[model samples]
Target: MLYDEFNSYKNFVGADVFKNKATEKTDILKNLNPAFPVREYQKEALGRFYYYVEEYHQKQKPIHLMFNMATGSGKTLIMVANLLYFYQKGYRNFIFLLALATLSKIEGGGQI
Candidate 1:
């Protein structure tokens, strides 16, 4: 999806959803059962990344983002959060491209 389209969609759908509201007193988090609680640092990093990607898309530039997360850190959780963010921004089709080894790792992990 292009950046302008994504931005327009974001505006149309309401940007408040993207904002992290779990910080305010609320039972929403407890009810939703998020995979892992999002840290303040993670939220800031995610917000920045989202802005950068949206800007790149608007400029019609190629987008390449890397998350140098440690193994114990919540890499999958971050990835899922990004996916959800884009989906909320009006993206429907998603193609996850992974290497053969990574695919193998997921398959093997599932079998374990």
Candidate 2:
């Protein structure tokens, strides 16, 4: 899942089901916000997340993914990237940004 590299989802789903739609969406986002600045790790992470989504769809099982970063480590950006990627896969009403009691307290409060 390199930035300039493209991933093919030809295994789990059909040969051309998504057709690199995730890459297309990411490219579109990069073009639209050339200055928005998505880090390399973010791209790889979101790409892996998208891969898991494909796995979930093919297996009909729940898959859990997590992103751990220090405070203000651009995790919010990762979260948003995740949401947008899956949204393109036709998933609506995503639940995001939940944490356990201690972690929630560390954040002071979670909103949005």
Clashes of each: 2, 0
What is the overall TM-score of model 2 with all chains considered together? Answer: 0.50
Candidate 2 local Cα displacement, residue 28, angstroms: 5.9
Task: Report the lDDT tens digits of candidate 2 across residue range 1-112.
Answer: 3222224444555544343434545543464334346665555555556655654344334655567667756676567666666676788998764554543543335322
Model 2 alpha-carbon drift over 4 Å, by segment: 1-28, 31-35, 55-60, 98-112
Candidate 1 lDDT over residue span 3-68, tens digit each: 455457558867642344323313322332353576665554465466566543444346666776
Per-model TM-score on C-alpha atoms: 0.49, 0.50
**Ten-residue segment with the worst summed lDDT in candidate 1?**
21-30
Clashes of 1: 2
Which ranges of candidate 1 are over 4 A from the true structure?
1-32, 55-60, 97-112
State residue 74's C-alpha deviation in candidate 2, in Å. 1.0
RMSD of 2: 8.2
